[model samples]
Target: MHCIGNGGFFMWWWIASAAALAVLIVVVLLSSVRVRLKYYREGENDEVDASLSALFGLVRLRYKVPTVELKPWLNGIRMKVAPEETSGVLPELDFAREEIRRFVQRVRKLIAHMKNYKRFFADTLKHVHVVELRWDTRFGLTDAAETGMTGGVVWGLKSALLGVASRWMSFERLPSVTVTPVFNQPTFRTEIVIRTRMKVFRIIAIGAMLVYRVLKRRGGWIVWLRVLLGRSPKESTA
Candidate 1:
């Protein structure tokens, strides 16, 4: 009778452990999910505010990016996550803070690169004034012709800017990010926020479709078999 009791207890323990593990996995996956985004623009300036929530709103992240002077002029990023939200999932607060710092550094580097590119382009155009003048004289263009040429140049520039904007707006580096815990009593909520210009969900969908197509064409069964065997397809069969 004691042996049977012991067996039942062990079985219940195993079931309980599996249940807890499943719940933990679900919480972790949902905790940093992008939930909402709000965008506002005032003349040449724009701002984007986004929120990320986890565990059915038990954990939340909020961030704001205020583009003060426009494209290249970022007014710095402000992000905060509540401390209560970091209880079980996050191991340490220091690690989370360091991660946020690294992200800010990356943003600064990108901004600097953009500013340098703008300066270089402006200088190049200044140097080309003589060439532009020569072209104008050689063409003997009328006012209407000059206006058309200017319009074409402006259209090309607008298209190039749009292309760059589309690529930059895709948050390829960090899709969902968890912020460090802010210990203030009034604001003790774990937050994970992601603000992006382009529709990242759509991009992901398109990428997944492309990957599926490639895998299907290359024999999806072989790929699945290799994944189950814990071996890359490029590895030798031997």
Candidate 2:
């Protein structure tokens, strides 16, 4: 009878220890974690001005078992722009066209970089656990002049796993922008907000770790194969 009792106690002790360890890991990850960014620029002669700000972090933790609940959010991304003073309608039209061209070029560059980075980080990214994300964003433009213009856009994404192994995971961005000449002063404004809840499963985490090991070794071979096939070496193997 005593031996049976001791065995039962041992089982309970093991369970308790595991629970404690899990809690400790979560606490460590949550401590001292914060991300923020802000920027502003104004021309010396008040001809042009712009500003932006953003923040991301955990807001709450509800539970941790079967799945861990994390309230992660990103918000307060705002921007504004004002046109420079110029004489003649032709000059204003030219300035607007130039600004539109520059904006398109920047977007193209950003997309290209994102694609390259995703390919470069493929191997390492595969090991990241799945997450449920709730994202939201808003964009707006305002104009109060001879050629007034105004518009706003909102976007949202939910419950996504990020990695090549997860064939369903995907991200896309489509932007529609236009510029027109203004007889008077011109102005533009935009705002974005995002909220998310992430849950990680033990099985998925374990699988990710195992996959990472294999990917670390297979990465070189994959690159070589792509080269032999006349494909870009940076292409994602997964």
Candidate 3:
């Protein structure tokens, strides 16, 4: 019996030894995995070959272009001045703010990813720069209907029908322009009138639609038909 017990004890000791050895091998192999590096830097002003230089050339090609001025204006009588600088700057400011916000978000995500991988960033990361562009614009609109046509020798008369379309409502007239600064980086302030006929129609249509849906839900087909026909149920009965 003693001999049997001694044999079992030796077997367990050997098994434990083998398990420990296996674990040690795994740990060593894991620690041996070194990050693969493409280049090493030992000195400043090191020359890069054509291939290496081309790798970073995309930055230059993708740089943003500056817009000196953007002016969208509506003047008296529906006369439009071809692309001039005396308009409004509010829209441009809004666009710039949105762009900068997105850029910052992207950079933050990139940094987080690098941190996750236990990686180091290039030295170029330190010199990142963002530039903003400013602009001045003006526009005019007149009420003369002018037209030109085509044939062997043809011409068309175009009349300024300011009241004819929604676009003309923008030319209601601005006696003088005023600008006031609002929140955010460069600040935005401008005085301008929104669109006319279209805006009014849009509001009325939306309100009517909402009322129609509500009535239809409560009264079913009877209310819906009346709404579509531009008549109320009470009016139809009368």
Best by lDDT: 1
Q: Model 1 over residues 125-222: C-alpha lDDT tens digits?
A: 33221110000101112354554565466446545654554443432342321222222212212222233222233334444654554354435435
User: Cα lDDT for residue 180, model 1?
Assistant: 24
User: Each prediction's TM-score against the native?
Assistant: 0.29, 0.26, 0.15
User: What is the C-alpha lDDT profile of model 2 across 1-238, one tens digit per residue?
Assistant: 4455888999999999999999977765444322121121222111222222122233422211111112222321122222233223322112244444555654443333332335434533443332322222222233333243322111112122123235533222322223233334443333222222222343345446444443465353354344446554245353
* Candidate 3 backbone overlaps, count: 20
Task: Name the runs in model 2 displaced over 4 angstroms.
Answer: 1-12, 15-146, 149-184, 202-238
Model 1 segments more than 4 A misplaced: 1-4, 30-32, 35-39, 44-48, 63-238
Each model's lDDT: 0.41, 0.35, 0.30
Task: Provide backbone clash counts, one per model.
Answer: 6, 0, 20
Which residue ranges in model 3 land beyond 4 Å of their true spot?
1-94, 116-119, 123-238
Superposed by TM-score, candidate 1 places the C-alpha of residue 77 at a distance from the truth, in angstroms, of 12
Per-residue error at 204 for model 3, in Å?
Answer: 60
Q: Which candidate, 2 or 3, has the higher TM-score?
A: 2
Residue 218 Cα positional deviation in candidate 3, in Å, after optimal superposition: 54
